[model samples]
Target chain A: MTDGFVTASGVSRHFTPSLPLGERIVAAFGGAVERRSVRAVDQVDLSLRKGEALGLVGESGCGKTTLGRMIAGILPPSDGALAIAGEPVMTCGASPRKTTTRVQMVFQDPFASLDPRMRIGDALAEGPIHHGLVSKAGAVAYVRDWLGQVGLEPDYVSRYPHQFSGGQRQRVAIARALAMRPDVLVCDEPVASLDVSIQAQIINLFLKLRRELDLTLLFISHDLGVVRHLCDRVAIMYLGRIVEEGPTHEVYADPRHPYTQALLDSVPKLVLEEGAEVRFKPIQGELPSPLAPPPGCHFHLRCPFAAERCAVERPTLRPVATGRRAACHFAKTDLNIITGSSSSPAVIASGAKQSS
Target chain B: MIDRASPLARFFGEFRESRAAVFGLVVVGLMIGLALLAPLITPQDPYDLASLTLRDARRPPGYVGTAGFTHWLGTDAQGRDLLSAILYGLRISIQMGLVAGAIGLVLGASVGTTAAYLGGRVEAFVMRLIDLQLSFPAILLAFVIAALLGQGKWQLVAALVAAQYAYFARTAHGAAAAERHKDYVEAALSTPLPARRVVFRHILPNALPPLIVVATVQIASAISLEATLSFLGVGLPPTEPSLGMLIANGFPYMLSGRYWISIYPGVALIILIFAVNLVGDQIRDQLNPRLRR
Candidate 1:
């Protein structure tokens, strides 16, 4: 009971893609055929207390969606453990039927998420009907209520998904998820595919739902501004690991991890400090392929403050403050040092030279 | 706030783009009408053994022969009314196409969706079998099946279905496999809903449009396959006078001067199959988002 309603400890998802036929045949014949396993979610720990809105922010392929999916029970973790409401969430078809109803997910793409053949009413009513919360006779009224909860008109219930706009369809998806009456709602970039104007509306809807429903929200997004606006706490992910996590405002005001600082810096804003000489730009280097993640710290290759020890020793998440954790060797000291010297490239180059 | 267009509006808009589809619709509608009204429209029961005679056999069109207007399209060398025979044939052709299509569609869709949803060895086994079936041309497979069953109504339909269901299954598998991983399907499975319910209710419905278009096309092919088997003398008995039987019965006389015997029924079969194909193509094109323009 002390832990959050949903707890994921060292949960990971790895996929071993099969080779094509020609390559398979060659491999079968003993010819060399390389096989790579993608560690999509690598030993990530997350916890969500009831009625808490925790935003998971990361670049694409950093396993934000994968982590969300694992939480929602759509996918099983490759290793480690997860518990919902102190009951272990079983992977590989072992969880009871009731376990599925306890957590639900809202997907990113509304266009592809809903069945085009299904009427909106059926989509909304399916969960309640399946869960035996309502009979067929009562499903209509129940679905209407859920539809209203998602801000959709109950009159538009009979329409197909293709008949609705993307935003409307997303509302239906939310209603569909909410219909299960889940304690935890894992929204995997639900507003990423929406328009900027529409994104705000959906975010506001989520905020309102959080207030009214008192649901635990594991909101995954790359949008830092949206995360700051909607989340009470935010976890920054880099290469399938939570590099830093803290209260949203505190994290925004001062991100301890270099990766989090770089991510926050990338957000475009209208305001600028008058006569400011220092400006923030996106971090250098592409996100390395998950198949062959760099040794030690995943972000060590891209980190500006990479000293000799940073390349060889992988940093574990450690407590930096009362309710915050960061997985950097120098999370507290890096920002002060970077600010003190606007031209800090020479120090980083010299460190790398010394390490080599 | 994008205004929602009704499904009917979109369908009609797509239909208007293809004139051949409209023509096909008319022809198919006429054939269906002919099937339903076969008993009322036919001058004599082609199935009635006592009605056929040698005297009215092979008479040319507009004949002042024994049957008069009954020999309007000329006799099929059995003295059976050609128009009556054609009408009866429509009934059988339409029934065979629909029944076989339905059977094949249901079986194939179920199997395909199962294979796709439950991947791994299930997919491998089912898909390899579909591949094996696909390796042989559909006609050869149908010919072998019909050859085994000999000649009858249900027998012919069964053979055609056995030969045809694989393609429908393949179509369903391809579409269902694509739809299987979709987030909504995952979301449905994540509910208290059973895997079977999710597979059928959510996954299957999304997978059906392509299967539906394929079913229409399959019906046309099934009819053609039935006729081909009949023409080869293994489909229906001459007693049935299916369009293929009529064509086969009259095929020998085409060497002589009497061309109307086989020519008329042949034309009917062509029109029937071609019209169905046209409808299928139009529906497929309409369903395909890539071809929407």
Candidate 2:
């Protein structure tokens, strides 16, 4: 494994179910009920290269957000090792203050992410001032500058978060994260809650900030189309495990795992050709609960080409091609292929690439 | 140069629109004014021994006595003008209420914030202490403390403060705990701020509004407790003549045709408590935006 800027090796997080009143009453009869554990993220190893955007795509219940939180130091990894810039992140008694300054997270709901009571200026200055990145007056200037950088007017700084639109609040949240001057910015579905038109604006703003500030990004989203446009590399997560990982173009062009292929087929694409009707098929069945994830390859139950071996033996992530990785047994074989006759440039360009 | 059209101004504008709140404010303002102007507004000094005459004692309202003009509210058993005694008593009651409320607010806020910020054992310990204090009735707890310390203004104030601080602490602790989970507080923590600054400056301001409402309501409760303690003969000595003492001294003569003795001071106490409660209600209405709508 090369020394990428941010790395998580076999990281896992488990949450114990808190004993409710009913559970406590049941336990009083000398019968102990086993507490359930939710394996949010399991045995995941990946590296985010410096100054590159990594998109982590998964369904709602998948551990993409949990993995993002682990990287951001909001939730510590329950097992395995994590490092930033070759420095270890997960340790028994490490200072969280130091780790938090290195990486910041922009949450899914911009409104929920920002404090309603705080003014935009105070919200932006809080991180910078606390981190000793700047003096009080200097932090004010930094806040104004970052607000400007995020396409918000400097004059809007004095206003409260509720006074701003949803997109503007997200921009303020971005400004707050930037105030700390972190090396990596983990965006946990930053634009998932925004309007379609506003999503583009926020995405463009993120791209602009990433380029200008030389910031590494871990962008998590369920929307593959948004991920395809913004990320340099994409990782498809299913049932708390990354089913496939590759460069954005390669992964979307030729998704090795059946789950990845299904995800790609599910995204609605615009057919520019006259008289061409593009058919969209949504993924079948509901997501399995994290508490009792299936044995062997977690996706085996949902995979179209699941063999007996897939149900019995868990497949580890292995190199399928150059800069491409997949956890399926039949990586070489294109088991499931859904083709459309649209000559859209995106599809043509992506189809030729074959590795993300 | 504050903005006259700012959101705070708009909030106040909305506050004034509430008839209950406005009426409450007016009543509180008048009571506070009466307390402040006790000396200038009243002709007779409540505490002066020479001015008091037993000959005019327990006179009814509007009765003209031999000693100058009799008060419309008449006199108490001590011949102290009921109106003058009330004005003076209001001054003492207001002073004790404000002091005890301030002490409770400070002590409770500090303890509550510390407990909420440093959870686990500390939270359990502090919350248990609150529970212990709450389990015993507030007036009973005040009586116990007053008995232990002996009777004095400070003793009564101390008892009232102890009784009230627990409520403030519980409210502040809950508010601080809620604020602690908010993003702004986490954002502050992620910065280089020392834990104290994060807890005090950033977390405290946001947590205080709810506590402010609690404090306002507690002020009325504390005053009532003080009056109760005094009425029971464990608070302010006879010479001091607080509203509670006056009410206590006049209660025996209620059926003896001297209705003015108890009625005047009772009305004054009720008015003061009512005014304070009204103001507290207004504060609750104003501070909570959810209530306004």
Candidate 3:
């Protein structure tokens, strides 16, 4: 929390979706309604300094989107604290109006994010006009100027979202977010829904916009390659918690945790050299349901080297190196090799300990 | 947008595309013109007691009645010129329809959007209320309302408004509820704009096409409701006879073999409702491009 622009401490978000009327009636009669709490994000900590971009990468359903939502002031954490620019924001569900202008979000679906009936000019200019940043007379030019910044032509200002291609609409969305001059932009997989060719163009636009605006970004995506391409630092999440965090290049180059190792291994070319051994080593077993995560380490059931310690006690995120942390008992022993390292043959020893 | 057709040009072009709507436009336009020009078109001042002769009553069509006046459609039991009666009656009916429809649309759209945007208990309560109101036949509700409010033009308007507003409310709520969940709507909320502007300018405009379709249909239904209430002798005052009252009055003469009195106004009522309903149908089809073919 010290001097960080956006800081989250022990932020957790849980969702207990409402049951249907029939189900509620049944539950009232002592019948089961199967009401299960989904812990989308659990005990997460994240800090983003001003003008820094941190990529949150995880498999689909990991808490990346939820965490990104909390940072954007869109969703409240069920438990924990979040501060933006050192001021605590209203969280859980009621997003206070004051911080709304400070942080803006770019949605994953461009088509769904811009009103189809509204002209692009109105969509982009609404924020500036709403906050009294620019008078209505000045909003036209203000909108056009933002259009150019997002690499869109000024002619697009008069067009509706349906009139533009998917890429162009994404540009409109970006311009709409930037029009407010927000300090932080939470992009939740902004490129995932775009075409591959359009993806690079949007990514480059984001990079350029960040430089020109000196904006802080909390980027959430499942693409590790894109994360490495755009982020200065990266955090890998498993289930509802971040399993590893460090400088993007360092984590990509030397992944510390077994899950991180498996993530890099799963990607065909994330770490593989041009002729390096390319193996499709996707982690074994289905992702455990968040409804009932295993007693100890969430990933231990799938880990090849699951030790008795891994099964008995969940390892906390321990700082193993400067600016690098991993939530695995064997992280200090270098998890790339199947066998245990010298410092702790305890990994295999504990397996025998479990068997004995 | 690729088409450089100006908005005005595009509007006319789209209007031309739907032949039925164009037909509806003409029928509705003619009805409005007739309503506005009723004073100049009527040969006799039907409202004046001095303008009538009892001997002219029950005259067949084309009859040379008192003062060289000829009954075009024929005379009623009161010697009122049948054509004159219809023109004046239509004027009142259309005016009520327009006013009632406008009031109903505004009330319904506001209630619907508020129900959707506020959600939670507000949504549940508003939607349930709309459902409860809709469960009863609209005309029956109008009957009870008109009966309670007493007979007058404005009272009829109030009854029509109550009868019709729920349609707009339900349609508008459905559209706004869906639009509220869209990403653009969420993005708007994430901004510093006032909630009113977001709901009115953004949500309402998107919700309008569906409500507009509902509005056109409601206009037809409103006119019909007015006629029904008037037939029950609870709509417009007797001095200002509506098409529905005319039909009810002429019904007594039907057994006597002179049918022109009630039949003429009945035909006019059907034409008006049919024209409005067709236009509404065309609009619904035009709004959804999926139905274009």
Candidate 4:
């Protein structure tokens, strides 16, 4: 594969659950103990060209945030390599440490993201001043400039995080990340906790910042509409694996994987016809425990079109269409059409687009 | 208008809204002021052996002594004026509590927060040590240390710090551990700021409200513990009378007809501890974010 500016090849993160106190003592005394691993991000190949916004979409526990953290260099992958501009972001070892200052992350909850005791100016200047990007004397003006860029007033500097409204705090968080002058931004559900109107405002701010800064973005969210609006390319993750990836327009218009289709199908649709009943069909079953994921295809148990072969054999992500890749046994054949599964609003939307 | 005020001014403003807290603050201030001004305000120097006469000893309240001085609270067995001795004792008690509590707060908070921030084995080791210290009754631990170190003002303060630091460490560890998972700490970690800065500047400040509450309460307890050790005759010596040592000196006189000697100093210790506790309670209420309107 061509090396994108930020390249992640087979990156994975696993968490081993510590034994209970009694069991730990037993294990310490040379007795056997069971330890289970949660495969948060299984081997996933992905890359982002410089200045491109890649939206990572998944269900709540599917590890989109984990992937974003790994890309941001805040979290080290348990396996595989992640690099920014050919420099490894983290050292691979038992105790992995992030090696780069080129990537930064803006977290989801603004109320929790900025230090409560910190003044807005200090919170914004902390990174720049520490990294020697700005002198202490210059940090005030530097902080003020970034705050203004994020649409906050320069005078709001001295106010603590609690003094600001949620939207204002989110703006501060964004300004703080940008103040670090990082080349890549991994925004882990940045606007997911905002009010709807505020979400639009922040999204627009992100759009403006991305254009002006030429920032590489790994935008992680479960919100499809926001992802479609902000991202140039989109990757759909399921149970720690990317099931489909393509240009945002193409993937939204023509998703190949069953998992991606189910996700797209779940998006609430507008039905304005008089007396027309709106249908609400959620995906069946719980996400199987990551501790002991099923053999072969992880999604096979929950898959509506799971065949015998799908239950016994795993599918690797491969080219399915122009600029699109999907991991499925029959990516070329459009399974929804073959199986005559529940009619997807996504397909109907695509049909409308083709006709128009 | 309130938003425009400086933080210190705003804190005081909010602090003033609690009448009980203000009252507590005033009483604590009076006690501290009286303690500091003991030598200047009191008529007799309680430690001046040349002045004290056993002939006037055990005098009832408001007796005219041979020295031509008014014994309002009477005198102890050594003929030391009860009021003068208490003021001196208050100074020693307050000084010891503040010194011990402040030192312990710094040491314990640093250790606990660092352990919590590091997590895993380091946290387990530090926390176990804290637990071990805490399992011993605070007074008992102080007694052992005071006995081992011998009776002196600074030695007593050292004992109190050793006995009291575990509480601070436990509180700090709990608060810092909870705060370690907060998004702000994670955001700090993502920055190139050193790990120490992340632990102290980012996590510690957020963890401090509870620690402040703990500090105030611990200071009050420190004063009480010193009193207990002295009452048991293991604390400050007679030459250096803390409230505890004063009470100890008068305990033998309590069985006799003269109640003024012991009762007056007992009252003083109660009033001091009460004032400290009231102030601590007010501080806890004011510092709690939930209690703020």
Candidate 5:
């Protein structure tokens, strides 16, 4: 499949301090109005291929959701450009209805996503009805079919969201998104709030939908296992920028960046042999406030491999291998490779050869 | 037949069992019946001045008057039958309360929802207006409004509507504001649904229960406000005697031997207010989950 159905170039969004009560008083007293800028997303360039499931793996405050929101056009970017299927992402001034119909988002909390007062059928029928995609009677039939596709009973269409379980609500959310027949689906941790078994079910459903509908998916999650299982390619974000990105297997098997390596090592392995040695290097320190991100490399304060040069010179995402990229100066050499205990010399050698 | 014992059924059943609500329902129902059957039930047309006999005027209840048993509750200062006056007066009072409450609800819901949804400067302005209105006692505001508009049933209704709309608007605005940030609202926005549809069809319906309770309570408040205005002589015109007017006119005779003339209408007024308050309380209980259990 061709790469990049939806693409963002140097997209940035900043939220300025609103005129708070204190600020208003200060202004009245002839004091200087101090407005702080919170850069939620900063100059991030990314692309999602057609029918490809691209997982955005990051910690809670890494701005993955913000980036996803920008991609969905729910929030307008302060600067730069975003496009879907070779067309510019419609602005707020333009026909907002048309733009919203083309792209849809499934939020993290499923229960909150569906209106409690609305019956499932009404909720599902709303989009199609507003868009004039189907007649009212046709929409009812379509809603039933979509419900079945999401593994919900057709008879349950009349039920309210509160009557359903968490997983069922999420399924209803998915069904709602599917009803729009969006070209790109941006799911912001759709399974994060669900149970582990339910998470697996949702992940499987996402994978299934991706194949069946030939849809482009932007899946956001902090769970590495989930990213590894469902994503075709993975983008690792730190602060508000992509630190490492490549094919899912490549990034997991041989993560070149120090941050990527640390993340992989932190994952609890199934078994450890005697003297196999588990040097767990959990990511130290809490994330700094986005309102005032540190100078130079944002990760330099917490990065283990931080040098004098690393602190001064900010790194940009540069190509490392074919279809793979990372934003570290020492991405190729400084990262320590950890070979699997089960691997033979021949297997390791062959694997290294294949990677090269 | 249906199970008739579901949670909703139980809720309705509890409402039916509430003494206050039941009493209020009965009183309201009786008042409505009285209004509908006023012409047929009453022996004298209270509004017709020519039909009244001067000799029967100022007679107390159970008095051996010119009319005898025909005027069972006796006659007013104008020789109007007290029973007939009460029926007609109640009709005016109930009409004023309902119309005023309805106007308040519509006005409040519109203003409040608009202010909340389109926040920033609009919210501040609307909230300030609400604060200003709330500072004055509602009954005082109604009296002032009625005085300015001139005294009549419609004028009093208008006064009550003006006094009570701010309360409902503030309530509905808060509810609508809370619902606006909900994920479903955002979800609706993310879909191809129009902004108007998202705000009204999706968000407004979910936000209405609290406002519904507020509207119910306001009905009681509206009735009381109207009565207070009428008692002060700034409400309904003298031609139409509401319960408040009857009480006002009978106050002088209250000191004399005839107690039933003022006492019966006062009792009816209390019972009507009590019934309305009871129904309002039950609605508040049913709508609010914390109060339900």
Candidate 6:
């Protein structure tokens, strides 16, 4: 991960909720003052090589969106160093501001992602014209080209956002980002809001655009199947921290982290044999609140193979094999804990530790 | 589902759908025209003391003046023609409302949008000030300001702007703050365009519909506020009599069976406000997405 193209090292984004007037007055009279900060993204290290697609997979409130936002230079990190191709993305000061234009983001909701008042052509051309990528006179043609690239009609440029369907709006959003000539594209569940048929078409568009533009992509989603299909590498997040990261095939085949193993096992599998019964074992335990995450491992309460050390000591993300990392105290141990039987898709194998 | 017309044309297209709004628009246009043409069309210059005669004072409607001109709406204590007084008053009242409303909208919308976009302590400070100001009655605030900066056209305007700006600030802050968190705004910010551009070009456009709705209603309020101040004798100077002053000047005669003095100007004021409010209501309904159908 060292010397990668897009790098975020030791990044942390903490947000303190402001107390309302009544609460402040109550606290002034010696009432219990609530001052807990939400650690949305805490001390995370991630690196994406140029032209490589990294899938950031996690359940809701796992901070995948916040991480993607920071990487795309939309939200400034509370603390960390983020760089794209050796150029710092955020300017350091009392209030950090995003300084780079090398990255752009695609939001999950197409309906809200576009300005309703602006015409499609104007929305797509706004960034390019401001950045001097195209002249005002040339913006129409530039916007049309980008629109066509995203499989939208050039004539659709004259319309407002409300005039388009969910699928069409997402296409327009992609074109708007691409018009900025961004080297890195951060898609935060771009197709999650679209119809199932539309999702496949948009996914195909992303695949085509990634190859054609040779772009470094950060695909953030909770859908494991989509991430597995689209991403080359996958990083699993739990309570604002990356717990495991590796090539998609290796991690899906043999998940070292117990959390990752449980997540994979939770996915329903198809049985082709006659009279084959399928049992769905959902991961046990609720996701702890990010406001006050468990002191040690965030996944300890949910991990089937959680040891005594897992509850007390925080496990750093350590190398468990070539091109793989897992944050678990027993990740490299010979503790054979069978969370599911052989019929279960994910059988915990202590054999990965031997390779390390 | 696409309309190729410009936004202004589209708004007008939608505006014409309501018959009452159209009638209000026509009445408003007619009033503005009457005010603008008052100097050439009025039979008398109401401000010219030399043209007045004390014998013509307190005449009932349709009385023949000594100058051989019929006072269709009668004369006040100063014998100034009520019709002429109202036309001139229209000019002053409309101008005060528009000038005050425009200045208030721009000043307060900027303050509010800036506060919302640059949130945290700045927002808290601006919002608190706005809240404190809002807690006071608008007319009371205007009265206080008018009392402090007494007896002039500009003074009343200043009072109206000061009194009404908090409403604009509150409205703009709410609209812009809601818009600031929308995905479009975040997407605009991610484009790396300057923050100023994002605030004005992106956030402001979406926030403006509500501000515009506020502006129309506020303009009507500003006009009424000016009338109230003038009636209280703290508004426009005697040299520049407005509708409220005319109504106030004629009030004493109302008990003496000479009702034309105050009644005519009061009726004019009501018509103007009614027309304006009608237009404002239609615009509010039109802009609200829930009532669009």
DockQ of each: 0.55, 0.33, 0.59, 0.47, 0.46, 0.64
* lDDT tens per residue, model 1, B191-285: 75788898889888878889989999899888888888998988977767578888888889998989998998889999999999999899998
The digit string of per-residue lDDT tens for model 6 on B1-293 reads: 44467677778999999999999999999999999999999999998989999999889889999989999998889888889999999999999999999999999899999999999899999999999999999999999999999888788889999999999999999999999999999999878878899999999888999999999999999999999999999999988888999999988888888888889999999999999999999999988989887
User: Of the pair 2 and 6, which is ahead by lDDT?
Assistant: 6
Considering DockQ, where higher is better, how would the candidates rank from best to worst?
6, 3, 1, 4, 5, 2
User: DockQ: which is higher, 5 or 6?
Assistant: 6
- The 10 consecutive residues of candidate 2 chain B with the worst lDDT sum are B1-10
User: Which lDDT tens digits does candidate 2 get at residues B1-293?
Assistant: 22325566676787687787778778878888998999998978978989888898888888676568768788888887888889999888888888999999999998899899888787999899898998989989889899889888888889888888999899889989988866666555544356788788767777888788888788887777878888999988777778888889899998877777877887888877887777677778777768656
Compared with the true structure, what per-residue lDDT tens digits does model 4 show for residues A1-356? 44799999999999998788999899999998888999999999999999999999999999999999888877888888899999998777777777678999999999899897888899999989988999999999999999999999999999987777888889999999999998999999999888999999999999999999999999999999999999999999999999999999988877777788778767778864688556444677899998988877888898766767677877888776667888877565333244222234335433543442
The 0-to-1 C-alpha lDDT of every candidate, in the order given, reads 0.84, 0.81, 0.85, 0.86, 0.81, 0.89
Error of 4 at B47 (Å): 1.4
Q: Which candidate is the best by DockQ?
A: 6
Please provide, for model 5 over A1-356, each residue's C-alpha lDDT reduced to its tens digit, 9 standing for 90 to 100: 12478889898888887789988899899999977898878889999877888999988888899999878767778888788887766565533333646778999998799987788899999998878877897988999999998888988887778778889899999999989998899999999999999998988888888888888899999999999999999999988889989999998887766678768767777678788766555877878999888877788788666666567777778776778888765566322344222123324333443443
Off by over 4 Å in 5: A1-3, A17-20, A90-98, A271-280, A333-356, B1-20, B63-73, B257-259
lDDT of 2 by residue, A1-356 (tens): 54788999999989888789788788888778888899888889989989989999999878998898788766678888778897765345643433447788788887777776667788788767766788987877788899899999998878877678889889988888888898899899999999999999999998888989999999999999899999999999987899899999988877777788778878777864687556466777778788998888888777666667778878878776777888876565332333222123324333433432
TM-score of chain B of 5: 0.90
TM-score of each: 0.92, 0.90, 0.93, 0.93, 0.90, 0.92
TM-score of chain B of each: 0.95, 0.95, 0.96, 0.95, 0.90, 0.97
Residue pairs with clashing backbones, model 1? none
Cα distance off (Å), candidate 3, residue B123: 1.1
Colliding residue pairs in candidate 6: none
Give the better candidate number (3 or 5) by lDDT.
3
C-alpha lDDT of residue A99 in model 2: 47
True contacts kept of each: 0.75, 0.22, 0.61, 0.63, 0.63, 0.75
Query: Candidate 3 chain A: worst 10 consecutive residues by lDDT?
Result: A333-342
Cα lDDT tens digits, model 4, B18-79, are 78777878888999999999999998999999999999887887888887888889888878
Better of 3 and 6 by lDDT: 6
Q: What is the lDDT of residue A281 in candidate 1?
A: 73
CAPRI band of model 1?
Answer: medium
Residue-by-residue lDDT tens digits, candidate 5, B200-285: 88778877888877877787677767777777899888888788888888778877866666767777777777777777777778
